[model samples]
Target: MLPVLPLFVLTVILSVVSKPVVIRDSQFNLPVVRKLNFTGESTIPELDRARSQSILKRPTRIVHGDAARAVFDVAATNEALQYVTSVGVGTPPTNYTLIVDTGSANTWLGAMKPYVRTNSSVDTGQQVSMTYPSGSFSGEEFTDRLSLGSFNVTVQGLGVASRSIGFENVDGVLGLGPANLTIGTLFPDTEATIPTVTDTGFAQGVLTAHEVSISFQPTTEEVNVNGVVTFGGNNPSRFNNPISFVPLTATSPSKDFIGINQTITYGTSGFPILANAAGIIDAGTTLLLLATDTLQRYLTVVGGSNEPDPETGFYTISPANFARLQSLFFTIGDTAYEFTANAQIWPRSLNTAIGGNPNTIYLITADLGTRSGSGLDFMNGMVWLERFYFIYDVGAGEVGFATTPFTHATTN
Candidate 1:
């Protein structure tokens, strides 16, 4: 079991500074570290898939907001398969390790480490609560100095979790999702929308553009600093090709998050896997999730086991069949991005970390539960993003993709 703390505690002493401090270059990068969270039991892909579906099925509402950018280094853990970064809160600041999530929009902490009140901490007197497919938290809302990289938001809204469930090892989440999702999260102020870290930074003139970009590299290590989150703008050196921009899909719930429209095909044969459909590109999810029908089509072409592995809940292929696998192509906008053969398989070296047999081959692509045409039919999660450079331009309502060195690499 994880440690549990009281509802409120004051543990740190720090001096207060003016709100919204810009202490670094216009484009600053903060280094983040990734570490694994093992439950001592086997990892379950079914739970992850259910959580992702719940995230995508969130109630839809229309709201507008701006964004900002900064660069932060991100690390990944093999067991949980998430990218995390350290964020500083309070005046002098208490650093907390937070998962980088683009699927939900409520920045919060106190799941592991209790929130330390500083001279700069202000209780908003509003109760905040957010529910996720895997976890849930209810807490008092507070605004304080939030430090991301070198940029600071003097009065960023966040939750100080009084009670939480399902979150272990990490302090909380750094929500890089749409601001509209923040609505209805606060009690009594159910109509209010809290500005995200990116939005607040841009409003305070700390960022020039309302955008954030991500770069991830495939890795076999249990824990690796294999990614970077660039705020405000794209990092030219991260990608080899020009970025291709696509308008955020207007399809229902998909448009509520970082959603887009794309089609999928298998190899040079152009075997159709999924038709042009709306889906989300999320950092919070670990697997490459496709609709049930789409996954079935993919499995038919790949010739994997019809049944999911009991332990991992992922389809497995024999070594002989694995050798016959081909790349999957994702055509977004006009460009076709290659999802290499090796990229489809989970990192073999870290197989045991998730309680899988080292000799078994697990595929990252899994069923999204619902069938296609579910607006949010597919989700390109961490495994998929690892091969491409991703950008979310909040101000322009567009998402961009570009090829990285890892796009066709055999690192997995």
Candidate 2:
């Protein structure tokens, strides 16, 4: 059960990411980022700016039924996430579009939307009803086989949400841990058709996360953003010294949305670098979080001088000390998170000169976030945690952090 006060901190930490351990490089050019001083066309707003303006629309619905399973965080080589997707769960089962979450382990979908089904009630928009404070979700399920890497599972559950909490086009979330929400389990015996995780990819093939072999949708029409997340193997063919890992504390097999002040340790030199760091070892979250004090210190370290933003205090970082050969370490309990030559700093984008100032930044995003209308609502963010393999060991009340095969371009 999620204690009341804990999630409040989690909400703050999960909602705000982008500050932690990081390694910046200016080499290995990638197509993901390209604009230095925005020319004319500017699209989506920066994460800091967007999050500061609103509350998250997370649905904590409990649609208990013999349907749905597995939550995978889908993404492309570009690092852009594939929000909505489809998958089938169970034998003679049903399907749902689950939120591909990296934060929690629960995979719940809207078996029912958040509306009074009256005449004017449209089935679109947000249906996520955060009985707590997150928000509501609206989407459905699809029945299909899933695959990733050399592994595949038939008829697994996945969530697809339409209404988003932060970004403009978000479909849903998929909890990516053992002991998932209502329908998913770590063992096939837990339900029918759900195969043993051992059949997919885990040490000894012993069904590491629940009883099902987590699956992914195949890419086709649109960049399915679909891929496999193998356990016990880091595909040495694809990366360098990829680390071997396991969960933190397993007590939180399901959505281990631990306490907010939970420790996040990175690497083996584990010495709790930052104290009571406000963050989450969320598989669903693709970013790290940092307090304002921490954020500023980091920006300065990355050669940031901090300029003004037309939208208030939000600012972006320029390529000043952009090519430092430094590695960042995150401390959560005894775990440490680090990156090897942090990959793409950011893509150069075009903008319509805000407040008449010619854009002069590279890939740095800045802002003194304000949440819940709190005047001093400035916050930490989720940019730093994007390139690490996080372990939210709920069973141990401790979070673990490991490095990823991260590489960056040593050019501006």
| Candidate closest to the true structure, highest lDDT | 1
Runs off by more than 4 Å, candidate 2: 1-85, 89-99, 105-135, 138-171, 177-227, 231-239, 242-278, 303-308, 311-314, 321-327, 331-344, 349-386, 390-402, 407-412
Q: Summarize candidate 2's per-residue lDDT along 1-412 as a digit string, tens digits.
A: 0100011101111111222221111112111110111122322234333323322222222111111122222222222322233323344323333334443333434433321222222332222222211333334433333433223454344333434242222223344433222222222233322112222222222222211111222111223232333332222222334343433322211123322343322234443324443333332322233445555555555565565455423345554455552545543444444533332232232222233223454333343343222222222222343354433322223333344443232222
Candidate 1 TM-score, C-alpha based: 0.89
Candidate 1: the clashing residue pairs are 20-154, 29-71, 32-73, 67-210, 69-231, 69-232, 70-231
- Cα deviation at 260, candidate 1, in Å, is 0.8
Relative to the true structure, how large is the alpha-carbon lDDT of every model? 0.74, 0.31
Q: Residues 273-365, candidate 1: write the lDDT tens digits.
A: 989999888766778989889998898889898988887677888898899999999999999999989999988887886668899999998
Query: What TM-score does model 2 achieve against the real structure?
Result: 0.47
* C-alpha-based local distance difference test score of model 1: 0.74
State which candidate has the highest TM-score.
Answer: 1
* Total clashing pairs in model 1: 7
